[model samples]
Target: MATTAEYNLGDFTYPRGWFMIGLSSDATQTPLAVRFFGEDLVLYRGASGKPHLVGAYCPHMGTHLAKNTTSYVVKDGEHVQGDSIRCPYHGWRFGPDGQCDDIPYSPKAPPKRACISTKKLVERAGCLWFWYDEEGGEPDYDLPEFEGYDEPAWVNWNVRCLGELDSHPQEVIDNICDKGHLEPVHGSLNMELFENEFEGHVARQILSAGHKTLAADGGEPMTNDTWYTGPGILQSKMIGEFPSLMLIAHTPIEDGKVKVWYGLSVKVQNTEPTEEDRALAAGYEEAGVDAFAQDFEIWANKRPCLNPMMVEGDGPFDKVRIWYRQFFNPRARAGEFQKRVNGRYVVRGTNTHPWDNAA
Candidate 1:
């Protein structure tokens, strides 16, 4: 089990991006302990309905903010006070900015050093995302939004928390450009129109694929458009019988371990779908999970590819690898890497989006 640093990614151990920490429903009045980017974090929803993310330990005495076993600061069985959370050990109240605003025991004002470290947390697309950066800076880009999430015609499934896997996230990210594995790994037929576009911090892949499970009459040519907002969040829109959006996010938990989340939404034929339509949606979600599981099984069973021996038909693996490296380096060093390896690459098809009709 080699660490991420052994791959020679860059100066940073973890890539900087908007990584999915938990589901939107995970944040309640009671704080939940989350571990991502190799750090324990506290996640909770405020009275204002906004999500807050901060380091788990209390700065005063180093107590876990969300794991208090005894009845201490919890009121009504929840340890939430407006938008601030109190330390169960010493009753130190910390705000969303990770600053200690009140100390129940101390009469004087809290010291400047009594502040917890905070990260930018945003709730979108039925999930909670945190912007992680080694420099502790603002998000370089916003998370990708799906308009269907707010529309009446769309019905979403509960986010599937896949928990932690003993594998590097890079192994999963490599699947985006892995066109050679479509037939062998995922059982897709006529996997044509394999193209990838890299623009700034975003990357996209478009293809026309088909699966036997999706179409009973042999298979139909379905347009699939998959794109990554940053280094972690990948969303895909599949156009076949109905418009569908799927989300796959992988966040590093330790040097060689990663946490994954899966979610899917489908457009209803009518505002209120019939029982048949509901069954179709359920089957669609299950199919999406099974598709990802194929790659997960391979990742868990294979050795780390510190340096890959890619072939011509393997797709733009080298270019995608370099694009991914930019995140592991500081923003200042990203430009140098981008110049060396940055540009749109298209093969077997044009860069036009395949989800235009679906959207």
Candidate 2:
């Protein structure tokens, strides 16, 4: 497990971005105890059914906020009230903002200092997202709309929560510019085009290729437009028999360990998906997950690549790393890193576009 400093990414140990913390189902009246960004955190829904993410320890006595079961506060169904959660140990209640709303045994008002730290969260596309910033600032980028999640002509994805990997997210991120891995690892047969674009706060890959596992034989090559919004979330639009959208979100559990999720929303050949259409979309999603697992397995077993011994046809790995450093550094200095890599780079011999114009 190599630390972020080992990579010399930036001053912050964790990057600033909107990170997926857990599945939407994980947030319920019964608070969930989970860890992220090296902090033990609690996630639960209020009476209004909105989810909240807050530090797990009660500020007053350091009791685990959501870890007890026998406490009457929990057994009496008083654990969660409205949009607030009570400590299972002492019944000290905290609001969604993490301020101590009430201390069951206290006569005087709760101290102004009595509050747990809270993480800003949003529920979307069947997952909970948290904005993480070392500077304690609000989100600097927007989370992807994950379009077609619940719209017609598309099958809503039940995001596959693939769980945690004991590896740094840097490894997972390197995939976007890793054209070399396509042919060997992902069965990307004869790659026709491979190029990357590094715009401010967005890193994109445009690929036109064939795949042994995810494509049909003797068909048009798979065309994919993939990108990362900030650093934690990635989306890919794959044009195929049924156009599909792929999502991969990874966030730090600790400095060197991270959690990951993968999902696919498939557009069906109907205005409203029927049972048959649903079944077919599910099969496509499953196949997409299978394709993703190929990369997941490698990240699980491989050692961290702090520095890649770059070679030709590698699809600009060095540039990708430089672009990723923006997230790890101070937001004020983000442009410094982005300016160094923000441009289109077409690998030689791809031959998918004219040499002068990428379009």
Candidate 3:
């Protein structure tokens, strides 16, 4: 497991960004208790079908909001009222803004001081993402959304929560610039072209992986355009006969461990998902999971690469590390770090991959 000292990220303990807290399906009218960034949070859906996230504990009586079942107002068998959530302990109702709106037993209006802190959240691309900042500010940027997420021709998997792993996210982020590890780590070979572009909080990597698995055919190299939005979300578009969108999100649960999630949406050939589409989607997802598992195995077993011994053909590990440092520091430090790492790249090479832009 890589410690913060081992990784040497920066002053901040956790990076600020819009990280996937859980799947959209994980939340309903009832609040679901979740923990991220080493803090407990409550996630629930409103009557308007919108998701809400707030500090887990109610300000009054110091009770966890999700555990308050004694005085819950249930309509349609759901514990939520409009966009408001009631504290089970004292029946104090908190609105979507985290301000106390009402007190069941009080004639006077709820005091302004009797409010709970709310976390910013956004629901997009079939996932629930929450904004986290060291100073409690708004989200720095928006999360990237895929094109055909909820369409009929796509088969969406329920979020595969992989529990917790003892590893820091920087170790996972390092994979973006690791061209040399592709063949060994994921069995992806024939890397005719591998390039990384860092623009602001996003890092893009284009890989021409010679067919090992997850390719539509057994012979053609797969051109994959993968990118990280902020510090947590990694989205990849695997171009093949049956193209797929890969969504991988990991958030720190502790100093050296993270809760990981895997999800994929497969584009079906037919207008509606048929049995054949389902089978193909299943196969594609299985292959992707297998490939990721290989990476996990290394992460779980290898010693921390805080200051890796870089050699030839290691790709831009140092450059990616510089880009990643922005998240671990305050705005002042991040700004300076960004100036050094933010830039564009057009890595070109010889390749017969169908999706290759360069000839």
Q: Count clashes in each candidate, considering only residues at least 3 apart in sequence or on different chains.
A: 0, 0, 1
| lDDT of all predictions | 0.81, 0.88, 0.80
* All candidates in order of TM-score, best leading: 2, 1, 3
Comparison by TM-score, 1 against 2, better one = 2
Candidate 3 regions exceeding 4 Å error are: 68-79, 213-219, 344-359
**Candidate 2 lDDT, 120-140, residue by residue in tens:** 999998999999999999877
What is the per-residue lDDT of model 3 for residues 122-212, given as tens digits with 9 covering 90 to 100?
Answer: 8887788888888666676776766678787888765687778888888899998887678767777566778788988889998886766
TM-score of each candidate?
0.91, 0.96, 0.88
- The candidate scoring highest on lDDT is 2
Off by over 4 Å in 2: 351-359
Candidate 2, pairs of clashing residues: none
lDDT score, residue 347, model 1? 50
Best by TM-score: 2
Stretches off by above 4 angstroms in model 1 are 75-78, 274-276, 346-359
Candidate ranking (lDDT, best to worst): 2, 1, 3
